[model samples]
Target: MTRSPGAGLHLHLDPLGGAAGDMFVAAMLDAFPELEPRVMADVIAILPPEAGQAELSRGQSGGLAVRRFALLPNRRGEEAKPRGHQHEHDHGHGHGHHHHATTYHALRTRIETAPLSQGTAAAAAAILHHIALAEAHVHDMPLDEVHFHELADWDALMDVTAAGSICAALEGATWSLTPLPLGGGLVRTAHGALPVPTPATARILQGYEWHDDGIGGERVTPTGAAILAHVTGGTAGTRRGGRLRAVGMGAGTRDLDDRPNILRVTAFAASSGAGADRIVQLACDLDDMTGEEIAAAADALRAHPGVADLVLVSLLGKKGRPATRMELMVYPAAEAAVAAAIFDLTSSLGLRRTELDRLILPRSATISVEGIRVKRADRPSGATAKAESDDLVHAPTLRARRQLAHRTETG
Candidate 1:
């Protein structure tokens, strides 16, 4: 098929009810149905015949049509573990099967050895690694020592693999999600009743925004949290203006009191002018701090994650006072964290925030011409390349620096 205009492209997830591994798979597959056959084939190639068969079926949630994904067990005894829920229950009745507790090493090995495309396997492994890291953090143990009780099950593995494979297939597209819904109340687990957002899920969502829905339940599972962490990197997505290409709705297992438990994935056609995205502009004026303190503050802001750029300008403030004016370009998602960092690192009483639409050209960096790194930006007219100023720091003189930069650019 010709993929109906905008398929397998930039993805923005709306976790209307909540998110899970199956929900992620369903949403992606729903948006791009052309990928179902290959996704399932790849998933089956990795697991044994008796494990289960992957299925993508049409369903409805609160009268809303939706697509659902699940793994059905072939044998009679090994019923498919319920899909789209947290696996925290302790299967102590099995005596030795810690719900098939699989170590981080074992899970990594499985993904590595699976018969999946290189991109798919690597992406899948990275997503799963996010969960492992969360678990390690929550348990206060090293990454190598972390083991999953339910996340290691065949269903979870398949879900992660399916999500990864789909992501790989949708190459070159950026992924983003809305602020995750934070459900209230306690949940039962191996360690007894824990709060709504489990420890692992909480750890995975450290820097991301949260939307409290007041309703109580496990809204974001560890698998879902890991997928979001891998996709957005704890940053908000840019605002892009373009035609909405396609929409797919995936249903969650639970029935919520307020809204239909469905997650929506929307894909957009690539926009023009290289690229256009949104950034938060933060500006503050400080006359009390000395140059050293202002410089320190700028350094801290620059080092913060999601802060794209920072500038410090000497300007005249109120009453002809000489002050340092600080302006920072930060990702919208990281605005809160960056604002907190600014307050902690500077003596500024207040700062100004403005959301700006930024037009940026496609760019990449390459090292060449005496190992000097050059950043090349693609423009409508032509491509332009510039050598990194820091790379020329070792030049003995200004002329030498210019010569090196010219050589790097020309070559």
Candidate 2:
């Protein structure tokens, strides 16, 4: 689908309620129709040995016809080992040490060399790196040297690569996510029994907002955390003004009583005239400053180069004393400059700053300079000219600089 220049895209991640890689890949496929076959091949190739014989099938669940890749652990001529003794006594387990690094590296190589877009490859690499880094930190080893026992499993490799491919396909879109659900309970892994949302998962969830649903089991895995962390910018909340286009649900391996074990992802298209908009909100209150100084400070703040919007209000403070409230909205990258300007131009001791999501219209502006018209070009509607000045004033836009170079070449 062709999107306008300022279109907004929304992506939602259902962490605690979904399957690991399967849910992620399914959601992406729902958004991009062309990713199905490539993802299926990756999934089939990476089926972990522990999963036994893996097969892909189509089925309907929750009124949606979807692809279900089911993996059955090899059971022929083998009996289930006792829970506690399985690790040490089972001869079929093969290697004493898990070759996680070798498996992950091989999978990564396959993904990197796959017939995929550049964006897809880079995104897949990033997800793998996140998983590897978490494992490395947990084992107290360098990221490149540490092995990923669980994540390196074939299933994980397929899921992550498919996800990367989907993300790469949507190159120019922005992703917004909802709050993640972190299910409650304990989970068993190679590292022994640990609380649900293990240390690695916790690290990934550190700055994000999440709620615990009292369900027992591993709701979110390291692979799931890695994928969410790589895509969702570690922030969660609602977005307004975007129209929901498509939604996909991916089911988990196990069933739960409270809710269906599934992940839901939704895609959105921004309303017309909506462009990329971000605002930095700055606020400070002071009771000591005189009215004159307060007015001066407000004027200076408005004059600052980076300040886009500014506000000042008077309010009653503690003990019925009057205080001035100063607030400013500016571009995200210009936050530091706005803050510096406030400090230099005001008498408040400290300021509070926050980043806000905003929608802006597409815009362009022009400036005039005194220079010779070295080059001229005629468009279907209007004529454009490029000029050069011997004295350097300010660096021109890249387009302007390119035009100047073209003029020089022709001359």
Best prediction by TM-score: 1
Q: Which segments of candidate 1 are over 4 A away from where they belong?
A: 1-8, 75-101, 278-280, 290-308, 313-323, 330-345, 349-355, 361-411
Which numbered prediction scores highest in lDDT against the true structure? 1
TM-score of each: 0.76, 0.60
Q: Which pairs clash in model 2?
A: 46-154, 52-74
lDDT digits (tens) for residues 139-220 of candidate 1: 8998878877546457777888888787657643556677888887776655577786888888877756788877667888
Q: Give the poorly placed runs of model 2, Cα more than 4 Å off.
A: 1-8, 41-67, 70-107, 114-118, 237-240, 272-282, 285-357, 360-411
Relative to the unseen true structure, what is the C-alpha lDDT of residue 95 in candidate 2, on a scale of 0 to 100? Answer: 24
Ten contiguous residues minimizing lDDT sum, candidate 1: 88-97
Candidate 2 Cα lDDT to native: 0.57
